[model samples]
Target: MQHLLSRSWTFFIGLATGMMLTLAGSGLASKPQDSPAFQDAARIYSILQQIREFYVDEVAYDALVDDAISAIVSHLDRHSDYLDRNEFAHLTDVTSGEYAGVGMELAITEQEVTIVNLFPGSPALEAGVVAGDRVISVDGQLLADSDAETLLMGMRGPAGSLMHLTVQREGEPELLNFALERRQIDVKSVSQRMLNDATAYLKINSFTQTTPQEVATALKELALAPQLSGLILDLRDNPGGLLDSALEVADLFLDEGVIVKTRGRYYEANVIYFANTGEKISGISIAVLINGRSASAAEIVAGALQGNRRATVFGEQSFGKGSIQSLFPVQPGEGVLKLTTAHYFTPDGLAIDGKGITPDRFVPSQVVLESLLTPIINPLPLNTVVAYQGEKKIQIANQDNQLRTALQALDHPD
Candidate 1:
């Protein structure tokens, strides 16, 4: 059913604790292994069989498992939960070369959806969907005053799906239109370029399986330039992927220190990650850019670099996800239990779960408000007084703004 798919989940503490106490008093003391646990197991099996045979409607076996997993994981922390087979496949396939969409990460605001970053060779990039372009309409349907995320949901579908979108670019008088057919998105995690003769720009979209090697290659490419002095490591819209990859990437910039430490309920889960003594970019001025979309491994990198005083962090706060999820095999080859096994702390022992990593210098974004939003809710005229919709967005207007800030701060070091 459409209502039963799931994500992060947690258990009810009072109920769970009470159940355990009761079981301890009545069951474990009596039989050690064959008491309330067995009874409850039998009861659940009976109930499930009864529902399948005599229930009002026929339920698929797969649906039953999905619902069961969702219910069981409901009482864990918000970061802990289950992943169905399809979801697990996609998750494990994160570094896979192809996905069906225009291949761009978007930041939605009150009035528009801005392109945060575009995947290389993606339809959006090929059709010139540059960062900072705000979408106005899709397939001739005006999205004026419409929630940008909702519009984006409509954009992704089956492969070969065609979408005609109109976007407003900054400092442009006319809107640009493109007709793009959705295809498998090819991901390019590391993008590097020279901002100037002495400055380099390196962006890691997400920490994927190949990210460590990609980052190494990117750095080598940047180092090819003779006069590279300052570097901008962009993790603005990077939704983190692999923890190990993040650790490896952070090790590249740090000489020696604890990158992060994980605390789990079980002793086996708790662990500490330390950086080795090989800093490829040693003595090079580094500036790390993070925003609301930076999370998980991205936060790990930023916190590690910042905590060690190896980089100047400049931008908005991060997405505040400090928990680590481990995928335990459900059976030999069926599915996996995506368990939120532990909470990770920054090197400086800051709680990053709810409190994100704050930047040293806060630079407000410079956005161009479109005409479409100007008329409609110009919409909650009282919005200025009420709940602001500009919540958590990657607020860097363009790549240059943050890079400029980084270069200035690095040059001055005063």
Candidate 2:
């Protein structure tokens, strides 16, 4: 109670004094504080006084104030949130895709922070972390009740600093503990490999500033292979990033067309983008893979390519987050407010907010895919059926239904 009162009173007093000084300079300080111009401000102060005096339980006044600000912003949309100074700094680091940390890719699954992937040369990878590992604790703090954002906060640190992680892996009796030193890890958003003799696979984990160049380089390298017949652009489980990066990637394949259009109440927010003369991979047969986790910029690429009839979209529907968030800077070094300025549409004029892009060839993802793709069925005992709840047992050549279907489609493209 004392702490809150001291902090709140200190800040408001200074702010009030500043306003008074400014008004005095304008020769308006002599006006009564109860005047119409100051009515709402006085009322807010009165409410704050009442809360400090009569509230049953002591509350952190600063936290209450920030919560009020967040609540006001929450009325806007689900994607909008309040960011204090620290969170704003973290946001910058995240969008830049460069930070001093372990470089573990995480996904929130049923309120649990689970590892989805890891950067190739990351501290977490060196510490022996793998996909599907559930984070149980961090630095001795249990993560069961911790939110994903809070867990992420604990993951970052200064370079050379050490952090501990405990994870639960399937079929392992002992929990895996890692003591890792933080390093400057640049998350690679693009990965490429030759899937088969004639097909190349390129997986974009996210859209970052360097993604377009990385993709172009990958395509050029793949084109040099004499056996290359098709390319698979995988965006499955990709939570998207920069819109401009996605536009650049779309331009690599599209010759000319409106890639995406955005509309909003603000005059400046309504805009459109069209592909220019930079179609480097126009003649190559391309297949895009998507799932419920693919969103935002990923959706932009999928929608653009699919709308332009440049690629065959495969896999499940995408995660629909078709909105443009513009960051408005506050006073220097304070922070920035990320507000959704416009709702974006596909080139074909479809606004996919809740309804994601439907693939041309829809294959069920995850466990369902395993079941459908695993054509080699084991014979069971007569008059008996047993259920095994564990890791997947089947291993087939074309076990990935989406990839297999994509390969087949590429092989038989008309």
Candidate 3:
């Protein structure tokens, strides 16, 4: 199945900020009208104006404003951004889950613009853009020292417009240039496939307002198989989304008991979410896949299943992120504070902060053929399955191999 993966540095940074805000809000009362903080803010504004008039180096107003905004946001939290008019509009479009652009996520690291991940079927992917590509220039304009937001702005434009990008790909000496047409790209948050007659695979890319309904529909299709065996819930690179959606998804798999608990500064923010008792899948074996990129809501699902012994997890450790943010609108089309409101924990009382879920069977990902030429049936000898690790890929001849090792274990009861 075609799957899209996303790494969410944004959520990590935002949660850190929210946690600090929660701490500050808990002990401090509303400041007086003449508070020192407000006075300091006024003084700083005046000092900036004075610098513009007296500094030896001529400074552009726009650059100064951008720098000021960046500085302020940097101090508050990672998720809270100071977006100017254009940037604000762009952020809104992206968060709203629809936009017209090249469909690639970019980040700035040490003054170099880097492509993080390109959306599947996007203009950027179609133009051969891959992760880790350094964007040297865009439309003949050098962007090596540009901020990530600025570089992204340069890449985006009206739909149907053409843009040129000069990228440096790994192991390539000559700089490659790509002329791409911008298009309206919709980021899909869900995907499903039948792994076999009885086994199905469902991957949730992200949780959105409509994710619960989408997941329900996918499950219905999987249920169409007369003798459904089990499912492989793949959350390898899912970044996460709305907390409510996470709860809803967990409820589907869990019959009863606490799904997750949240703790925050305010008593009101602390909450315990439970699953409905009589609505769980019985006698169905489930296996979940995770990696360093699986985070937030993905962690919630993994934690729930692991706690209840409902699924056998496989893959590397997950991305350790367990903080929750609550968005508070501050102004009309101006800005908002995405404050950290709470910390979440699995029902088994495991802290997920900086501590990821350890898979029961650690299996490193391997690049297998798109379609297995010869499908192995059940009750095959254990040594026949292949085990791929490191640079050396080896094949086995009988039932004693690793794949058979897992299959044999699954065949026998715990």
Identify the leading candidate in terms of TM-score. 2
After best superposition, candidate 3 residue 15: deviation in angstroms? 18
Off by over 4 Å in 2: 1-65, 168-176, 366-398
What's the ranking of the predictions by lDDT, best on top? 2, 1, 3
Candidate 2 residues 84-157, lDDT tens each?
67665665565456778877766554557667667788888887998778889888888876755555566667
> In candidate 3, which residue pairs get closer than 3 Å at backbone N, Cα or C atoms, i.e. clash?
18-340, 381-399, 382-398, 382-399, 382-400, 383-398, 383-399, 383-400, 384-398
What would the per-residue lDDT of candidate 1 be over residues 23-127, giving only the tens digit for each residue? 001111344446787787678778789888999999896678678877888787654446555544444444333457777665444545566667777788888
Each candidate structure's TM-score, on Cα atoms with residue i matched to residue i, is 0.72, 0.77, 0.73
Error of 1 at 96 (Å): 4.1
Model 3 TM-score relative to the real fold: 0.73
Off by over 4 Å in 3: 1-31, 45-66, 76-80, 84-88, 105-120, 128-143, 166-176, 277-283, 367-414
User: Predictions ranked by TM-score, top down?
Assistant: 2, 3, 1
Greater TM-score among 2 and 3 belongs to 2
Error of 1 at 133 (Å): 8.8
Best by lDDT: 2
Q: Candidate 2: TM-score? A: 0.77
331 Cα displacement, candidate 1 (Å): 2.1
